[model samples]
Target: MSSTLPVLHVGFHKCGSTTLQAALFGRHPQIDYLGEPREEPRSTEAIRLVRDSCYVEERKRIRFDPERSRALWQEALSDVAPGLVPVFSKESLTQPEFYAAPDDPNLPERLRAVVGPARIVIVTRHQIRLIESLYLFHAKGVHVEPAQQWLDARQEEMHQYRFHTVAQSFVAAFGRDNVAIFPFEDMKTDAKSFARRICDFIGVDSQHGADLIAGERRNQRVSQRYLAYSKIRKAFGLYIPIGRMMPEAMRRSFNEFVAGGREARIELPATFVAKMEDYFRDDNRKLARDWGIPVEKYGYPV
Candidate 1:
């Protein structure tokens, strides 16, 4: 067996990251997938420090001890089998704050200091679909505001979809050869094929990794009616206390019961999607040209 290679799947979420992560967790003998750094106390503190130091307020900075963070990460991955590749997948690492400044080295440098040399995997979807999915995700998870209001509040963050900028930062820090970008649209079309590609990239046997291709999806989107009802419940402050009181499994079951098998359809204004498509046109073209992703295949105009 080849020596284990450390792989970090820093997600650009609203993509198929949950599906990929679920597929890889404990299913392959040659790969050890750690779901999230925050799941462990030591790694949580280390990640928090990395985030704090990397994503400070404008004109402000915070410092953290690198040696401590490194030690924490080393400890976190110590339990994995020696010959198996170590994969750490975390979706929150793609939050806009880390990439807000195009030139910032803090995020990548901190990551390098802790994880050392590792393959970086980033998965992205077209901006229009991604943003709409993100908006619904926020509404379901935390925000009570209407979609338009929530979107308005996140204008700056939406720019993270200019994927080349984010990918370039990692390329600069980790070298171009170590960075891999996959389209979420491609994954949705052929998840098994996509999983095989990732396995090949990480130097694991494709046959062994094939088992990581099928599983229950995590954080599936609820229907429009369900979301609207959630909004009303939040508006009336009826959801807050109930959400706090109920266990997560119970809350999820209750939500599923209320949704009554409604399909996962979200109805955003057509003009809104058109405008977003226009807004991301140049960036999508650049992604196609530079990264070889045929954005047009995913319905983005090239």
Candidate 2:
């Protein structure tokens, strides 16, 4: 096994994954944050993998080949440790459909097979707020069906699929001792402290200090038009061109005009908060047991 495997941030997305990734990649010298030519907003290899896998499936309208999927997994692993403690933060891994069961025996086995004895970090937030933010996130990208419907479908998928279960996959693979799970809310609330905690867990120092913890919610906007465009692309199943095809001028316009200014804070409803509290209670319990976290310390209703 390679001595330095990538630090996999298997996220429960909208949990400040982008903000943390941007801060880390923006400042850290030793880390190589992967993305496309035009400062790729995303940070995980798994997104491309999932999209590509889905693309192939849609084209043939068929199921994925296990051998092919494994090959792609190997290809993703190939990029690991090109630098010391390279970070891979893809929330898709937490998606339920990816694993047969949340506690599936195959997860850790597969991860070990690919990334070797790795340290895993799982970040989570209140479910209701997560879904609301996700709605805004999806909204900011492209226009689509009714927001409530989208949320419902996503919730179903999440419940059926489960993120907490996915964490077990890593624990099974790396052993409970090697995995460090933290609350997304806590990180946002106290970035410096969280960074120190994370550094301690991963055996790295925080070069940038607490100041690196800049914003509570970063890159939090998507305009109606952007959403509409996104919806069209999704419905038609077209690629939106990965990066750098547009001129700088056009990119700026898209950022300024279409994106409705960078990092706009999303507004969420109170009801969503109530729902999330109910949803994550069990998951939090399981996570607390697995990672030895004080659930009350994070102040989640759980």
Candidate 3:
């Protein structure tokens, strides 16, 4: 048996991570894709603490102890099976708090300590699309705020869209040779090919390509009508009580009624798109210059 090389997928969420997780988990014999470290007790307690700390909205409230985290990591990986590469994936690792340079408070350093030297994979989406998707995601979770209002409230926290800064931190901690960046656009354009590339990156067999490609699409957007209904329900703070009272079947029927046999597409305002492009222009340029990513592929102004 050969030794395992740990690979971490620190996600910039809503960037096809769910699909990638579904593809890699148990599909390949050579890789052990652990979806979230906190889900299993085999992970070190320190690692769990670090993961949970980054997993919340109020990350500033969470404190980390590095010495304890390192000790726990050593114990956790001490018995990892030989010849199988361990893949740890979690989207929260890309949160903005972790990238707030100089003031990052060593969050990224703690992550490196827990994981040791490992391959870091990050998937990024166009900022505009990502923000819109994020808004819809919150709406689904009963957040009633309008898009602009919600974005304004959380703008500073949405630094996952600032790819260059996030990438630089990871690269600085983990080494540039150890990191790989793939655009989410690639996944949407050719999922099979994208899966193949990722499989190669993690030293998995591409024979599982069919299984990887077959993974179901997750977090599909709800129709605009359904989203609007969710917003209204949330605004009234009625979804909770109504949800409790409604039978599962009734809830499904209600969804179907709102969907009206097809999902309604939510269109973004052109002005908002233009603003996002301008906001992210410099960061995207840095990504192009430093990481050699084709910013044009994301439709960013170069």
The number of clashing residue pairs in each candidate reads: 0, 6, 1
Residue range with the least summed lDDT across 10 consecutive positions in model 2? 35-44
Encode model 2's per-residue lDDT on 41-151: one tens digit a residue: 322333444433432124532343345544655565555464455566666556555544456555456455545566787777766556656676665453455655675
Off by over 4 Å in 2: 34-83, 160-163, 207-211, 214-217, 221-279, 289-294, 297-301
lDDT (Cα, 0-100) at 73 in candidate 1: 79
Q: Comparing candidate 1 with candidate 2, which one achieves the higher lDDT?
A: 1
Instruction: Output the number of the lDDT-best candidate.
Output: 1
Best first by TM-score, ranked:
1, 3, 2
lDDT value for model 3: 0.70
Instruction: Judge candidate 1 against the unseen true structure and give its global Cα lDDT, from 0 to 1.
Output: 0.74
Report the lDDT tens digits of candidate 3 across residue range 4-114: 567888888888877776655445677765555234354535655786565345644466666777776666566556777777777877766555542353556678877
Model 1 per-residue lDDT at 284: 78
Cα RMSD to native, each candidate?
3.7, 7.0, 3.5
lDDT of 1 by residue, 1-302 (tens): 22566887888888877777766644677777666522556666676677677664655446868988898878877776668887777776778776655446668778888878889898988777787787777777644666677777777777677777778888887888888888988777776777777888877887656556754456666776677677777878775645557899998887667566664555667776776777678877878888898698888744
Candidate 1: residue 235 Cα off by (Å)? 4.9
- Residue pairs in candidate 3 whose N, alpha carbon or C atoms collide under 3 angstroms: 2-83
Q: Give the TM-score of candidate 3.
A: 0.83
